[model samples]
Target: MSSYISLIEKGIHVSEKNVCDQDKIWSRYSHDKVDIGEELARVIRTLDKGMPLHAELRALSIGSSDEPQFRILETAFRGGLYLLDINDCALGIVQERIKRQRTDHVTTIKCDFNRIFLDPQKARDFFRDRLGKRWVHLATLHHSLYYCRQCCWLELFKNLYRGFLAPRAAIHAVLMSSKSKDPSTTTWLYNHFAGKFFGAYNDQDLRQLKKDLQRETVFKKAQVLLRTNRVNFYVDDFEKFMAVVWMILLYPQVHRYSLKQREEITQHVYHHFWRKKKPLTQEQDHLVVYKGLGRRGLI
Candidate 1:
């Protein structure tokens, strides 16, 4: 298996053991639910003013993980939902949950977003039967766009906007801003080391993405709105935090790192990012909302 796949498997195993405890997991990041809720509410309110109350709206979520976010989107939109994730474990977990909840409107596809955009024709073919003539009205890529390499993000955005979005559709995204508050010493070290293992983006990358979007003809009519919100993390819960971090890092070939180096990295993460005895708070993320009329002849 590829190192990425192996890392994901290990992370899934760790999650099953430690992070799967619903209570513990919820307690650690319950504020995230609140943050997302507020943002979704804003999006809904804005859309409602222009859309009919009973209008059926299709939605898409990239990197939708096994979380309640998809459920919220389905409930609010009352339409078919397309959820994409590269992690099979996450996709299966979410698919099963949706089944149990009787949320038959959701369709989970296990694949990388990059692959989908790499060949737009294939994407259209794969989704055409299921989607028919409908276009997605609401889409989100929350805390997930970073998974794509910085340079490829613009193309991904172009494909998503052109191929999938309906007329006047809104795309909401939350991304870590390099311009945000300075990282903690541990976070700095973690990013430094982690970048060696995976493709990651900094603030400059995000700025470039925005610039590219502005210059793109497809998004010419798009009105981009930006906001920031500080997210709090539980520093007292080291194991839980690491579980989440490992899942994000998902590049588990530790053979590249010497034993001592691994130990040092772990200690740095725990001390700086986890903050040991102190509560950890991340700098506010840049929440960008893109709204515009769809193009004339795309897809």
Candidate 2:
């Protein structure tokens, strides 16, 4: 067996007590949430400018997971929250939270909108009866654009702008820069390992999306705002760190890292990241779109 496998067998790095689960627990507990939390707050605050004050607002959260956005949006606006996610676990978590809280205005829908979002009629047909023809005042694709192919991005945003977005609304999207070279960065780490093993990684990101949106006439009247921010994730435990590695790599589900490939990635992250005490730095670009804002929206 390779040294990586031996480490897993011996359970020295992750832990011998509760094993991998404990590592995951520590990782989640230690993740830096403040920066992203503040970013969301800032974005929502801006979107709040045009929101209906006396009446409740309508919003859609794409690829919704149990994250800070759900809580923030639910509190900031007293309207229906449509949760769209393809992953069962993610949707389940948010659904459970809603159920436990006895939340009335939250709706969870499990779907893979990658291809579906490209088709306007399909999107409208799917959401028509479900959404009661109530267009969203705000929509968010939080850290979920990785699944969307570059070719589909234009059509996807076009659909939102022409179909889902209300008369005066905005869509906020956050994605990691795919061009960064900083080793501590999540972008670099993905490029390093995924490129080495698979020879390919995400070539499209928020920057490219920004440019694409700007070139299109559909968004000519819309404000395509872009900004950058940094956040880091780290844990002393190897298991926890590996969990984060897998998370970043989109392992097991999205990306099929072969067992041998997994072993290879395991060794690389363990030595270079875990041993060196390097955080998985994520330098993300934020994109916000507002159509027909006039002077009401932030320029």
Candidate 3:
């Protein structure tokens, strides 16, 4: 979470509401819907295919509130795990879990990743202080990049490649398409409602990321793997379903839908989805950037 909003830029956001709502959603089902575990596993497996998962290696997962792939990465990297999220509550939950199940392997940091844009040097130093001699061997953004403005995408990756990621490392990011054609998807809902009400179109999807990784001067040397996966979210409870939809739209934070707009959107969902007993589905685009994969420049 970063941008003009000082609260967001400072990572002062809370996640109690989102956590509760997200629980209702994730508690129901996965893989068939919003299960990115398979793709994450593929990232580790691909990196492991060529490089060994050294015990001392490190990983930094941005927006790790869900703490979905923490253990998977713990096993894959066999090393220090840095859990970063803008929401302190999310960090608290993850920290508690880490304390209960693991040793001092996990370090949770609550800060907006957009701080890099505000102060690149300061942000780098902040992470460096925690990491010390460690450099991130595998970094993940998950579905968290939506909090960042599209303009900052390149800067974020550049900083990661140059200052954070170890050589031969990879950064995996998954984002829902901003221009999805499916009415049951988040992208389409945002485009239809937000576009109509807020007059904004989401251009911050993987296509833009692919262009940057493939054409950017620093990223052009890297190997990129692109794919798409479908995640469906459907709950029998109408309130719970709407909550997940709001989370998907990033309501109040990103769009700040008006009460009327929220009602309209809710009604739309009810009429279209709840009545029909269909799930909200999204086609998420996957992007994996492999540093120094082609024997090219590492950064």
> Looking at candidate 2, what is the lDDT of residue 16?
23
Ranking 1 against 3 by lDDT, winner: 3
lDDT of 3: 0.72
Model 2, residue 175: distance off in Å is 1.6
Model 3, residue 44: what's the lDDT? 71
TM-score of each: 0.75, 0.83, 0.83
State each model's C-alpha RMSD to the native: 7.5, 4.0, 8.0
- lDDT per residue (tens digit) for residues 30-125 in model 2: 443455567667766666676556867778888855666678778765678888888787788888888899887888888787756789888788
Clashing pairs in 3: 33-232
Q: Worst ten-residue run, lDDT, model 1?
A: 290-299
Residue-level lDDT of model 1, residues 1-299, one tens digit each, is: 48534443443344333334533464356366567767766776666666677788788888866655665787876778888788788888887887798888888877777777757786687558656757888778877776777777777777777888877577777654554334542234335666664434244345557677888887778865566666565534555655655433332532244444455555655555544454444443444545553322111
- Candidate with more favorable, higher TM-score: 1 or 2: 2
Q: After best superposition, candidate 2 residue 163: deviation in angstroms?
A: 0.9
Return the candidate ranking by lDDT, descending.
2, 3, 1
Q: Give the best candidate by lDDT.
A: 2
lDDT of each: 0.62, 0.73, 0.72
Candidate 2's TM-score reads: 0.83
